[model samples]
Target chain A: MNAITIEGIEKSYGKTVQALKGITLNIPQGEFFGLLGPNGAGKTTLISAIVGLVKPNAGEIRVMGCDIRKNPTEAKKYIGLSPQDININNYMPIGKIMEFQGGFYGVSVKESRRRAEELLKYFKLWDKRKAGRYQLSGGMQRRLMIARALMGKPKILILDEPTAGIDVELRHELWTFLKQLKEKGITILLTTHYIEEAERLCEKIGIIHQGKIIACESPLKLIEQHRLHEKAERSGAFQFVRSGSLEEVFVALTGRPIEEASKKSGEEKWEALPASLL
Target chain B: MGSTTRLAALVQMEFFRFWRLLRQTIVPPVLNTLLFILIFGFSLGSRIKEIHGFPFIVYIIPGLTAMGVMNNAFSNTSTSLHMAKFDRSLDNLLAAPLKPFEMVLALVTGGIARGLLIAILTLAVALPLLKQPLFSFWLTLYFVVMQSVFFGCWGIIGALRAKTWDNLATTQTFVITPLAYLAGVFYSVTILPPPWREISLFNPLFYMVDGTRYGVLGVHDAPLWISAGMITGLAILLFAVCVWLFQIGYKMVR
Candidate 1:
């Protein structure tokens, strides 16, 4: 069974701004899926729709075989989302936050307390467990978000820019932890700006451009498929090139150069990544 | 999760925040009630000795208490719901295994909880200071709780419909404040001119304020049956609207 199945889901912000056109995809159980996209590429919108934060204009989404709209209570039971924003409650202590989240997922208070201790120490936040959200540093807050997302022991984990602000050492540590979760057969859907992170961690990658899924392939498949197609330069002194990377494939598929966007107005230029490029 | 367990956790979180920010949540209304009691009860009571044989100071306590309950209940849900949107913490709650009615219950309970606390604390501070007697305990509790729920639902609807901070401020100033003032919080509607008094009858809050007045001092402008029926009916209707808004995810979509 698929962990999440989104079928032809369309969302529009207003009359003019179509945030998502028609997105159809399925991530099977226990699969590590990565969604890579530039700014305004509908990755956040898709994630929001999956988590039921945004209602779609059309089509359907199912989480763990339960319809997200019709059976949202059951559908939501399987999802653990670490959203892009640092939206944790500043009033509650870090430990209480996790324990309360655990309670929402049917974990007993005693078991929640035990898991909170274990996860807090693992995330190096054990010392600051009593502190409120504002007391934590940026990276610590991000770590706390990840730890809290895992508190429910959810069947599917959705991480939107989960490692965006962390330092290199902690990022690697988190990667290891995520890999261990994958080994334990938990499906993970990750969206990131870092191509290297996607290549390293995700078993399959989907690249979205302007509200459309442009490609879904493994890192190696993407590399091998687009390797020889990169434009060759005969006029300049072209050096010997090795195999291509996922970053190159991403640019070749979706990126629009900045010089053209410079011709538009400031506002249009700001939105040119997926707007003018489309 | 069991539905009740989810509801309990959400309600607990709401109370936890209310306690965490005691200055913002609990202190302001209590302090406001004290100031109102001092200025209106002491200063104004010197001139106007009695209305319907009760001291001017004693006459306004129930109204003041009703206003406190209504305003606190309204602000509690309005601010809490708006903050959830401003900070995007609402996504977490929506993603949890909670039904729409559950969310409504948890949120409305938060508002009711804060409202009832303010009512109790206001009377605790005022009754002894003014030396007023409680006429009907059950009736007082009914009006307090009903008005709390009424304003609580209105707060939810306002928060959901508000697009900007200005919108919420506009509603509070033009809508809620006027309703509370026109509800006869400080004076009996009998003091108003004939037409104006009839106009005030249309204000739903009049029933609430007059109900509490009747509850506390055994004095009322309208029939007891109408006030009780109107408050209960309006509260239930507004609650149903809130549940519908949540069920449809109204005004909360992209």
Candidate 2:
């Protein structure tokens, strides 16, 4: 059975803005899956729906075979979501945060404290357990979010933009920690902007564009398909096109150039593509 | 895990947050009650002999106590929920495996805890000055708990409906505060003339204050049964509305 199954999910914001248009996907048990999407691409909305924060207008979601809408409590027990932003109680200590998170999932206080200590020591936050929230650095706070999410010992972990804004060294450290967690037979779902991050970590990548999944395949398969298409396009005389990287495949699939995102100067460059590319 | 365990955890966290700000939460209400005692109870009350059979100071103590309980209860839930929304931490609670009633119960528990603490503090300070014999402990406890629950539920509704700090404050400022002052806290409506007394009878808080007075002082303006019935009915209505709101995710989830 799959770790998560989303069938015909649809959500809309306000009157005209459709957030998720019949989103459907399946993540097999113990698989590292990545969901990539640009801003306003319904990534957060989809994550919210899965975690029961936002109710979808239509369709159903199941976590480990428990339907979310029908059996929310049972479904929620199997899943943990670490949202993109730090939405923790800022005044509480790290240890207390972990304990409360565990307790919210029905762990006894004594057991929660024991598990909290273990996780804190593993995350290297044991020394700073008593410190205030402001005392922790950005990287430490992000690490705490991961620790808190794991407090429930959830079978499936959903991380939304886990490594968005941090230095390279810290991001690498987090990646190493996440990979270790993945090795423990935990199904991990992640969303990130860094193409290389997804390429390195996620075994299956799903690129969402305008509330629809445009491509869902292994990174290598997506790169190979994009390479063949690029070769087909360069048949005339454009000789020196490098083999398409994950970034190229992402840009080609999403129809938004990464270079255009990087350029600070305001010049509208890309126009509407053919309906086929979309 | 059981739903009871999750509810307990949620309540414990709320209490932890409340007690962490002990000085801010517990001190202001005490001070406010003292000011009311000094200004109205002593100054104006000293000039006047008595409104009912009891001394003026004795007459107003229950009113002030109920007022403090109601206000603290309302603020505890409203401000905390509003801050949760402002900081976006409410999503953390939303993602947990709690039923809507469990969530509401936790918030209500936190509010009542704060409100009762303030009431105890008010009694501690007021008992020394006005040495009145106690009437019924159970009655006082019932009225205090019910009044706090009523306002706490109101606060939840306020927190959900309010989009900004000012919007939340508007209910307290424009509606609750005016009603509280006019609800026979400082002076009895029985002393007022004609239509004003009839108007004061319409305020729900008047029954709350009068009910608490019956419990504390063995004196009441309205019939004891009716006062108890009115406050209890209002509490039930407010609680039902809050539960319905939570179940529907009204203004809580988009």
Candidate 3:
């Protein structure tokens, strides 16, 4: 059975700019799924709709057989979302932040404290539990967000650009931690700009472009089946390479430069376009 | 999470933040109220005789109490909600499983708590300075609570609608502050000339102040029951509007 099912999801801002245009996806339980897209390709909108942050114009979303719109409390119980930015209560102590987050998810105070302690220690934050958010280093703050997301022990974890701005060493450390969750059989839906990160962490990948799913398959199959690999091989552009990487496949499918895909202005640019293009 | 647990968690976080900055959140309003009593109640009262069968100092106690409650309650929610938007911490609540009404209730609870705390602090100061004892403690308490809830809802609306800090400041400067002062805080409406006296009745805070004054001094400008009914009706109307705004995610989630 699927852990999350999104059918005919549509969202718009006013009469212009349809953010998500009839998106449909099904992520099976225990699978590691990656969603790759350009800046304005509705990745965040889809995630927001699932969490009930933005009400979609039309769609049906279910998590573990509970409809997100009809039974949000039950549906939300199965999922945890670690958004791109980490904005917590800055004045509170780190220990209190985790404890309250646990309580927000309905854990008893004693149980929440226990989980907070366990997660903090696991993230190497136990020593700094008394410190406020301003006292922590950037790397530690990012790690703290993931620790907080895991406090509820959710069945499905959704991470949006978790490693976007971190240094290489810390990024690898986070990758190792996330690997353990996959080992424990927690389903993960990750959205990322880093092709290599998705290739290394995800079992299956879906590429969205202009509010539509352009491709969905395993990394190996996607690379082999893409036309770029055949053309590159025939034209001797990558003569010594054994096979095209996921990055090459992504660029081929989206037909846009990686730099252009990563720009923050892309969202605004899309919004400024006419509805016909949107 | 159960709705009850989630609501408890939200309110707990708000209280924790409030207590963490007790000096900033609780002290200024208390100090301001004391200063007003010293200048207007004592310094000014020494020259002026009794206006409403009570000394000028005693006549203004309920007005000052209502002012403190209304201002503090309004600030608590407005500042917190505005900061939540600026810092994007509201994302935390939005992503949670809480219903819109629960979220509104949690925020309103924080505002009312802060307002009541300020009211109590000011009342403590007033007890020693008043010329006569308060007439009915329960009635005074009721007006204080109602004022807090009413202004708390207004605060939510201000925070939700304000797109800039200047916009918020303009509202306080041009709207709320003027209405608060004109609500018979310093002098009785009986002293105002014809149309002005009639206009004072339109300001909701007038009813709040008059109701509490009747409770505190056993003298009031309007009938106690009419004042009570007006404030109660306004509070309920504001509360219903806030609930509707929250449910629709007005100027918030979208």
Candidate 4:
């Protein structure tokens, strides 16, 4: 069965601002799906609707065949979300916060404590278990947030910019951890501005623009199609070899440059050129 | 329904949260009430003999206890909810299996629990200060529970409506504080003139205070049964409003 099914979902904030305009997609169980988009591209809105935070004006969302509107509790049981902002009460101890989050999902106290210990150790936060929230560094807090989301061992994990502000080493560590999680049969839906991360992690990718899915394909297929189109557009003999990176493919299809692409360093920029030319 | 389990879980988590914040939640009101009793109930009681055949100190004890309950109830839910908004941890709770009713119940019950702790602790301390017994044990308990539930719902409503910490404090300042002091906490409404006495009757808090006083001193401006009936009616009304707000995912979850 599909892990998540979104059929004709429509949502609006007030009356006039339409956030998700009839978005529909299905993600199979056990696939690492990447949702690539820029800011204001409806990535967060779509995730919010799927998790039942904001009610959609009209649509249906099913998690493991359970409709969110009709069976919210059952549907929510299969999903976990690590939101973008890291916001937890600073007065409480890290242990207490974990217990409270586990309890919210109906995990028994004894079991939750046992699982919390394992997670804390895995995330390297075991020693800081008794510390108040404000004492933790930013990266440690983000890891704690991820640990909280995994309390129920959910089948589908939704991560929104999970590594936005972490250091490069920590970012790679998180990526490796997530890859290990996918290998253990957890379906992941990730939204990120980092195309490199998406290219490295996801097998299937969907590019969202202005509240709609503009492109959906396997990474290899998307690259090949873009190469074919690029070859067709050129009339004169091309000096440069014919190869297109994900960034090139994205620009070719959307006609707008990726905002984050500009931040690439000089050496990295040279490396991103077509492998055929190199 | 799955909502049932989720509701139970949320309520349990809220209780845990309150327990963790016990110093902030429980200590201040108990101390404040004790201070009020010392200054107003003991120091001032020497000058004023009796108001309506009950000792001045005895009559005001129940009113002060109710005020403590109301204030704590208001503060607990309002501060917690507003903090949830500010910290953005509210998204975690909102994304869970719990429904809106479950969320409301959890917060209101947490508020009620804090209020009850303050009321009981204040009464324990007050027992040594007053010469006369303050209440018929059973009635005092009833009034405390009902008052906590009532103000707990009010606190949730205030929290949901408030956008900032200032807005939360504004509600307490403009609405809860004035109504509480004006609700016959110190004086008997019986001595007030014609229309003013009737106006006092319109305030729901007056019934809570008077009813609690009746429980304690057994002498009240209004009949004991009337006070009980009014408080029960108000509890039902407030509870219904809270439930309706939860159903629509009002400002609380939204």
| CA lDDT scores, all candidates in order | 0.86, 0.84, 0.84, 0.82
Worst 10 residues of 3 chain A by lDDT: A233-242
Q: Kindly state the number of residue pairs that clash in model 3.
A: 0
Lowest lDDT block of 10, candidate 4 chain B: B1-10
Could you give candidate 2's per-residue lDDT for residues B1-254 as a string of tens digits?
A: 46777888889878988799988888988899889888888888889888778788878898999999998899989988888887777888888777888888889999999989988888878887657656888899899999999999999999999999998789988998889889888787888898999998899999999888888888888888988999999999999898889777788778
Give the TM-score (0 to 1) of chain B in model 3: 0.95
Clashing pairs in 2: none
* Candidate 4 Cα deviation (angstroms), residue B112: 1.7
Tens-digit lDDT string for candidate 4 (A1-278): 99999999888877867778889999999999999887767888899888887788888999999998788878998888998888776667888788777777878777779989999999999999999888999999989989998997889999988998888998899999999999999999999878789889999999887788888888788888788767564432222323466665677765545563333323453676777376
DockQ-based class of model 4: acceptable
- How many clashing pairs per prediction, in order? 0, 0, 0, 0
- DockQ for each candidate? 0.65, 0.71, 0.55, 0.46
Ranking by lDDT: 1, 2, 3, 4
Please report the candidate that would top lDDT against the real structure: 1
* Candidate 4 Cα misplacement greater than 4 A, ranges: A232-242, A260-278, B1-13, B16-23, B132-134, B252-254
Please provide, for model 3 over A98-120, each residue's C-alpha lDDT reduced to its tens digit, 9 standing for 90 to 100. 99888778887888899999999
Candidate 3 wrong stretches, greater than 4 Å: A14-16, A227-242, A256-260, A263-278, B131-133
Model 2 TM-score is 0.93
Real contacts recovered, all predictions: 0.64, 0.68, 0.57, 0.59
lDDT of 4 by residue, B1-254 (tens): 34555566667666767777778778877888878878987898879978988677767878898999999888877777778777888778877776666787778888788888887787778776556675587887788778877888888788778877788888888999899999999999998998999999999899899888887777788888888998988887887898787666686343
Could you tell me which 10 consecutive residues in candidate 4 chain A have the lowest summed lDDT?
A233-242
Provide TM-scores for the models.
Answer: 0.91, 0.93, 0.92, 0.91
Q: How do these models rank on TM-score, best leading? A: 2, 3, 1, 4
* Model 3, span B37-146: residue lDDT tens: 88998898889888787788878888888888888888888877887887777777777666777777887889889988987888887898774567988998888888
Model 1: per-residue Cα lDDT over B1-254, one tens digit each: 47767777788877887888999899998999889888988987879958877888888889999999988888888888888887777777777887889888888899899999999999888777556568899999999999989989999999998878788889889988899999998899998998999999999999999999998989999999999999999999999999999888887655
